[model samples]
Target: MTVGLVVVSHSAQLAAGVVELASQMAHDVALVAAGGMDDGSVGTSLDRIMAALDEADSGDGVVVLADLGSAVMTAEAAIEFLDRPAAACLADAPLVEGSVAAAVEAQGGADQAAVLHAAETAWSPAGSASPPGPSGPKAGGGAPAPLTSVFTLVNPLGLHARPAAALASELGALDVEIDVNGVDAQSVMMLMTLGAGQGAELHVSASGPEAQQALDVVRRAVESGFGES
Candidate 1:
């Protein structure tokens, strides 16, 4: 099962728009928008946040991303009111970046903790190293060899939001440690920070069970211009 996400913002449009953008790369993950008041004015509402939390949950836990201070407070209040507070968490991250990152991880079938970490770490610099490698070697100590490939982003717009999301979503599913030009391939924010133009080369490296598969997928997507004509 995949974790779900909630976007809490002061503006209805902002919250809904963020969900729409994130959903492009995470279609299967549940994303609920809780924004504005009952009358559609600009404000956070406890009832709305509570309802969104309930609707976003689907057996799997939920991670909440809020835009402003009051929105965060409202989310916390909603969680505190929950009989099972552990089922949800308020991620301290920028609304747009955090929502997109969280959505990508959730789409990859990550559990609640992983999803929360993904969102919380969206603010980290793109060039920074990943959280850390798995505790130890595999049972047989026969870890897969590192698979590497280099491809130039050919799309006219380069690796923009949509393309970044596409690449991140696909790579996120693989059991691999992938880096595109030194940035986490599974992080949309980090990928976007590349500012990779049309002719920029992407150095992809991974070492895990599906390392080669992940490399191939990225190669095909880049070569195909990510389906953009």
Candidate 2:
């Protein structure tokens, strides 16, 4: 059906990574990323996504996949902002691979609803579930690195600027490759892009030799919601 596809995440790199995998599986896919960028201003990036969607919609309806609920909600709202149909699909997978595949399948004539449903099935609930990382002793001699950790944004203000900045700082202090699953575009800019509110769910991950220590720090920061008071 030549559906135009959109991929939303906390970081552009994460989105790129997932879509890359999907492209290998499928061809001629449209991958538009929205969220924070390294240069600053996720809002600007969101606008870019909106513009691309507008063009893509003119050809065939677009199927959108988001890394998290908040990103999906934001994309939904963004459609409204652009006066476009709120008919985009949402891939709620905790990782980029699942989400991108869902979007690709949707664009390739699969039912958008069904594809997104499948993606959601891959996501972990925000309870006591541990992240998807190695569970062995890590480089820092602590617990094995967790590639993924989820937490509820229980703070009243959600993840505000200070908290997000603090979270960024914490990530900066780690020694692993950090990424947000649901929100793939989660560079420091992606943190600002999602504008996650209270009661939101977040997933973070770190890989490499320092995965364990990085995972611990990320989980702690997530639990703290970046030191929110």
Candidate 3:
């Protein structure tokens, strides 16, 4: 089984909506929503969060994303109360974007830590504050030159959420640094920030031992129109 996700928010409708949107791309992932109080008021509920966490955890572990203020606190309390506290953790990320990224990564079969990284980095442009330089040691112990390529998006919707999530989630698992149109290819939010539409060129660059493989993956996704018309 893959990692699971829990979304905690003040509004029940908001939490359910986020789950609905994320489920589009990660249908197999357990995305539970814990929003509002038992009375359906606009507030956080520890009991609700705890119950949702239990529902989400499927032995692979669970990642929790919460909205501002008490929602976070409630989620933390729920996690702390878990029978296996270490089996779950909270992601310090935007409620919606982080949940989507986390869900995608989890659906891609990423471990809990990697899934957490995907969520926490959802709002960032690159993996780290500074751009990742070339990776992989060369034959002479030198850093390999970054590989670059360009692929035109042929999908009717181009680099939309589903495609972006697929690319970012898959690419994030590789031991390489990739940039698409100047945005980190491993960040779903960053890729969506490109606003690349149909027929737009995706300027891609990568480094590390898996650089070529990463480029090939992008090529396949774009050239195939991401399996769409």
Candidate 4:
């Protein structure tokens, strides 16, 4: 089973809304909302959080995202109460963005560590280490250029949330380092920040063993308008 996600918020509606937003990009991922009190008050509840942790987890681990400090404490406590505490962990990240990023990564089959990284890194910064130089020399004793592609977004929404998640999730699984118009291609938040709209041009480049395959994935998503238009 894929990694699951739990959104802990003081308001029930807030948690549910975040789950709704994340689910759009991660249809297959288990997303649970643990918010408010069972009595319907606007407050954090350990029991609620514990129940959500159990429900969200399948076999793979679960990652928790909280809205506020106390919610985080509650989440931590809930995780500790689990049968196998290591099966769940809390993420220090923004509630909405982290949930979405984590959900998409999990949906893409990323392991717990990678999925947690995705959430923790969400909206924190837009940077990636430069890939190490080419592994080996070419027949002519020179390294090849990175695979590149250019696509005009035909989708009505351009690089919106769902499409950005699609790109980040699908591309993040590859061994390649990719850049789309100079932004980290594996970051959903960074891609959305591009403000690219319909008809905008995307210059994509990739390096590493899966460079060509990574380019193909982006090409298909962009050319097909992310299956939107």
For this target, which candidate reaches the highest TM-score against the unseen true structure?
A: 3
lDDT (C-alpha, whole model) for all candidates: 0.88, 0.56, 0.88, 0.87
TM-score (C-alpha) between model 2 and the true structure: 0.43
Best by lDDT: 3
* lDDT, candidate 1, at 23: 92
100 Cα displacement, candidate 4 (Å): 0.3
Q: Write the per-residue lDDT of candidate 1 for residues 1-229, one digit (tens) a residue.
A: 6798999999999999999999987989999999999998999999999999999999899999999888989999999998899989999999998999899889878899988988888879653535555334542577655678889988898999888887887887887888889888878889999999899999988878799899899989999998997
lDDT of 2 by residue, 101-208 (tens): 454344445455545543454333321122343333455566454467777777788876455544544554455556665442123334655678888877776676
Model 2: CA > 4 A from native? 38-44, 68-70, 122-229
Predict model 2's lDDT versus the native: 0.56
- Model 1: which ten-residue window has the lowest total lDDT? 127-136
Per-candidate count of clashing residue pairs (backbone under 3 Å): 0, 18, 0, 0
Give lDDT tens digits, candidate 3, residues 45-140.
988998898899889999999999999888888888988898999999998889988888899898999889888888875646334343323435
TM-score for each of the candidates: 0.86, 0.43, 0.91, 0.90
Stretches of candidate 3 off by over 4 Å are 129-141
Worst 10 residues of 2 by lDDT: 122-131
Candidate 3 vs candidate 4, lDDT winner: 3
